[model samples]
Target: MPTSEFDLIYRYFSSLGAGPAVDLSVGDDCAILRLEPNERLATSVDTMVEGVHFPEDMFPEDIGFRAVSVAASDLAAMGARPIGMTVALTLPEADEFWINTFSQGIAQAVSEYRLPLVGGDTTRGPLTISVQVMGALPADKALLREGAQVGDLVYVSGTLGDAAGALAFLNGEWHPEPDAAEFLLQRFHRPRARVELGRELLGKATSAIDISDGLLADAGHIAAASGVSIDIECGRVPLSSALNSHPDSESKLKWALSGGDDYELCLTLPEEVPTPEGCTRIGRVTKGQGVKVDQDIDFTAGYQHF
Candidate 1:
């Protein structure tokens, strides 16, 4: 007998939906949620296609975790507190082993992010995962991309280019020491979403964006939205020791500048505001348009799907 969709939900996803805000979760037509007074909901969705968003041989557990984390990153960018999430998963076949392994990852994220799995759909077709994350924010308070002003210092949370470096290692571009290889691969497999840091920045940051599309491109978003130019001191972009193990400085810098999927936060703070720990000041907002980099490196706008 084949496993039914209902069976999959009951066995794998049913228990992952319990949370403080979830009134109704899996097994219901619609999940109900409660919001605090004076709080508004912030929601965003992200889709990960089998080959397009991840490598063909990527682990199922990593895929499940990555899908949820990437979706949650949008909430982080907006300085929202995660409340719940939904997953719409499509698979070519209902492989029990694969589903079980993937569900472990989902369970892990649900626990770590404190984001309950509300409701979603499972169907037959190409393998794809679409995750929608919902967060709560104080009314009238959100870190937006349009609030950056001239002279604000630009900052980014955490190191950049580790995921891109992991890709390089996977493609056999270059080999690093065992420790570096392990670090880079782990960075790719389980990228952290800066949720707490984002919340801490709500009042201090003038403008912010998550670095999913590389620094140059994501920073360009703030510039365009805020109608200001951003000048980046390429020498100041922080790199992890693992990434620095790569022999080619130019390639590492290119990955740092143009490599999408870092999942870090890029924000602009006023000159008077103190820089937060674990974040590096990379540049400043200037009176102009678009983004300008001090280094002479070849790169494009960012990742694009067409």
Candidate 2:
């Protein structure tokens, strides 16, 4: 007997949908969510296709977690508190082992991000995962990309380029020490979304964005929206020791500048605002257009799917 979609949902995903904000979860036509009167809703969706967003051979668990994390990153950028999420999973076939393992990943993300699985769909097709995350933001305060002003200091949470370095290692571009390789690979597979830090920056940050498309490109987004130029001091960008172990200065810097998938928040704060822990001051917003890096290295404006 072949398993049905409803069976799959009941067997693996039904229990993952319990949260304070979720009035109703799986096994229903629609999930019900509640928000406080002082709160506004924030939502975003992200899609990941096999062999594009992730390697075809990547573990099912990692794929599940990555999908949720990537979608939730958008909420982090808005300084919102996660409420619930939905996953639309398309699979070539219903392999029980794969489904079980993938569900574990989703469960892990749900616990880590405090985001419950609300409702979703399953269909037969090429392997793809689309995650839609919903969050709640204070009615009077929410981060935007258009508030950066000249003289605001630019900062980024956590290290950059590790995921890009991991990609390079996977592609056989270069091989580092075993320890470095392990660290980089994990960084790529399980990039942390800066949700807490984003919430902490609520009233202090002038503008913000997550570094999904690399520092230079995402910073350009803030610049374009805020009508200012961002000047990045290449020397000040943070890099992990694992990425620094690559032994190529130019490559390291390029990855830091143009490598995507870091998922760290890039934000602008007024000079008087106290910097948060684990954040490094990288540059400043100025009167101009686009982004500028004070380095001679050559690179494109981050990853493009077109």
Candidate 3:
């Protein structure tokens, strides 16, 4: 806990700008992000803190990466390509070492998504980081979670429940990982934004929302927003191998159906839309409200944030 300022930067923020997309990075007053002049900008912001959004002792580096990824995922949900980002830091103290590690993680994430740091603010607080990412898309082609009709196919990207399972492991509910426990653990901590997938779905998906919450809960958002009914098939849920192998798969499934924070994309598309390789066909859209799984799994009563 008693870390020095320089060491914090060296450990946490130093490895940033290692990737090709990072034209400029931390230590500068502002970073310059490059993009085609004609591209439109799509942007979003997310903030996390020591205790409010994560464990108090969560690594500062993971916190940094996640802060950016969450906001970027919103852009991805809209079918935009990432362009750049601004990071705002409110810390309890000026721990340079922590900031450095955080910067590296942010840069690492940006490397994956191709957005570099463009600008930001630093301040004093209880270890809070807010990131706003800027992305680009055609003038009028962002995907909204409101185009599903009575017969669209409900699709989801990537497997669900890994983050929730990781959280369970963190809370001591279980242990996981034969070959990549740390990787899965990092998923909950530093999840990647599905920008590429979102971009691919631009012309195909009728409706879409990044699944920050469990599939059921997020699909419900689309249902409510679009004034349609969603049928989320429990059997069709794209669960990770680790999740299916766990002893408490049912409860884990429930968690995936209710718990948020996965940050993947859930979409509704015409049966004709050529879904990308990894996307799963989970269920259907019907003539009513609420979400269910083949008429048997009721998700209308899923998690509610009070």
Candidate 4:
């Protein structure tokens, strides 16, 4: 690890911020950005702690990839396109090789998402990664949790519970076939943010939220914020083939409903609008408050910091 922060930034971080939207990048005290006319800026910050968020022994590259991907999920929920991001990294003790691999992973996500690295800080401390993402959308187009109306249909993108299934494998509570294991493990490490679908849902979805805190709890957030109730049909929630293959159907369903870190979007739309291509209709918004699932199940809402 390099002893000087300036040297580390120049070598590993500066080049990641070289896109056109960034007027000032890593060398400066703060990032200077240019937002297009009629566009609104959207910013979100996420922090991942060692052991709690990820295993300490996990690959350095995966840590970097998951950090950026999870942070960008917020933008997807808001129907905003990412412009740039700043990573504030805390290191217990820097390792040159680890930093290189981690930066490679971050660079990969930055390239794929078209998000430039802007400016941030690096300091010595418990292992943690905080990423602040900036995105933009046309004025009045950003999706909000408060927009869902009564009778709106609820939807979720992609399969749920695969990531939770992966955690089960890691915890030795579940054993899966090799192919299924690979798919589930990949889901845990690399979550795909639904940026394109979110953009497509703009002006269409009445309300939206990213499923980071489990499907039920996140849906409740929308219900509470919008002053309406949401009812999800457990039978209708989509599960991956990997989850379906597992023998314990009940456990799989529980994981799908209450397990966090799915990073998929749960949205509500008017009944007249056709369901988007990749999303599955799960339930509907009602006149009451709180979230209710059709099946009788008991579990915590999702991952909680406390």
TM match of model 2 to true structure: 0.97
| C-alpha-based local distance difference test score of model 2 | 0.91
Over 4 Å off, model 1:
1-3, 300-306
The digit string of per-residue lDDT tens for model 3 on 58-118 reads: 8877887788888889988999987777777787877556666767778778788877666
Q: Which of the two, 1 or 4, has more lDDT? A: 1
lDDT of candidates 1 onward, in order: 0.90, 0.91, 0.76, 0.88
Q: What are the TM-scores, per candidate, against the unseen true structure?
A: 0.96, 0.97, 0.85, 0.95
**What is candidate 4's lDDT per residue for 73-99, written digit by digit as tens?**
999999998989999899887678888
**Per-residue accuracy of model 2 over 151-247 as CA lDDT, tens digit each:** 9999999999988999888888889999999999888888788899889999889999999998888999999999999999999999999999978
Identify the runs in model 3 with alpha carbons over 4 angstroms from their true place: 1-38, 177-180, 295-306
Error of 1 at 80 (Å): 0.3
Tell me how candidate 4 scores on lDDT.
0.88
Clashing pairs in 4: none
Task: List clashing residue pairs in candidate 2.
Answer: none
Query: Regarding TM-score, does 2 or 4 come out ahead?
Result: 2
Q: Residue 211, candidate 2: how far off, in angstroms?
A: 0.7
